[model samples]
Target: MTAASRPKSVYPLGAKAVRILVADDHLVYRIGIRNLLGSEPGFDVVGEAADGLQAVELYRKLRPDVLLLDLRMPHKNGVEVVRAIRQEHQTARILVVTSYQTEEEVFQVLQAGAQGYVVKDVGRETLIEAIRAVNAGTRWVPPAIQKQFSDRVLRQELTAREIEVLRLLTRGLTNREIANVYGISANTVKNHLNNLMAKLDVADRTEAVSFCLARGIVKPEEI
Candidate 1:
């Protein structure tokens, strides 16, 4: 393709670069992100913050087109920041880049109106595409993040061990049988069952098992 036939951007010909605000607790990380995005051709790092509250304040003052946020900043955290900004400006474009992308974390931030979610390990090209996509009114997330988000929506929250126990429950396993499967004591199995019941909001073991079955939390063949 010729240079004149290259892909387009949201920016008009000879328009300003896309403004960006970055929020991270680590100064070095913040600086690195600033430089990385700043050096790009069509992007500009307009502001940077070391904490969530500062991120919110800077976003308000700068009103950048996009926000690159960290999940674990002090004061408010990335979720709270996303919530605050989207509350004030419904069209706010925010992206969360964090070291950890647990199901809960992805659910919280996306629920709070973040448009893009990615880990810090993403390549520069991927990050740039994510930022551009988000700025252009698109939602962007990695495959693994999408899977985690789907799991959060589809399944009730339970510990890994609790799910293991629940799977065994589907097979008519007694507490002792489940204990033998996991090599845990029967009391530990009982405790896991109790936690699962509470998390599933059920009254008893039978109800808990029924809830899991109804929700397809555990398949029969999986046990």
Candidate 2:
């Protein structure tokens, strides 16, 4: 018989199913994932969360074997949620399933304690494999994402103040305005810009903003 036609009992007897928690803002995607995983014999989606807050709450309540999380969500982004869950439960296993595949986003979530990262465009088999791997206590970042994460790690990281300046720069704010916002001098703001630009390897504020946006360092909505 074909794989799709195979019975659910095809797996070896006594194999325990992997419990999963699906967390995403979209209703349709959640349902789709539920149905897809439901069809698999060795997977059981125990709970669903519509937002990051709900995701954390559900994880606390359900304590599933694996958490399938979305990178972007309301109330708390994936990174914050991962940090929160991992803070309380160090053994938590989280797999980020997001539409975004930017190096910065992948690195941030993984650094925050997620075990794996996969884009939503992946095939069903790949997604299932990621969940199983995470459930088995293995990191599941794809080779391309791993390379991107490594590249981001090798680069000089920006300071918190520099990141704030970059966010303001994306809004077309003048150096003087940014300085006033922070109660600092425009010359001080200029120094921050110079430092950030050098670290980012960009020529000017415009290029810096573009680079940040493209790499998911600073989101467009933050501007």
TM-score per candidate, chains pooled: 0.68, 0.67
lDDT at residue 214 of model 2 (Cα atoms): 83
lDDT of each: 0.86, 0.89
| Tens-digit lDDT string for candidate 2 (1-223) | 4447635434566898889999999999999899888888888899999999999999999999999999999999999999999999999999999999876788889899999999999987788788888988999999989877865763448888998999999889999999999999999999999998988889999999898888777888878
What TM-score does structure 2 among the candidates reach?
0.67
Q: Candidate 1, residues 1-223: lDDT per residue as tens digits?
A: 4334544344466867889999999998988787676556789898889899999999999999999999998999889999999999999999898998877889999989999998998877789899999999999988877866765665656888999888888788999999998888999999999888877788988898787776667766677
* lDDT of predicted model 2: 0.89
Candidate 2, residue 29: Cα displacement in angstroms equals 0.4
Best-matching candidate per lDDT: 2
Instruction: State which candidate has the highest TM-score.
Output: 1
Model 1 lDDT, residue 220, Cα: 66
Residue 6 of model 2 has an lDDT of 39
User: Model 2 off-target regions past 4 Å?
Assistant: 1-10, 157-223
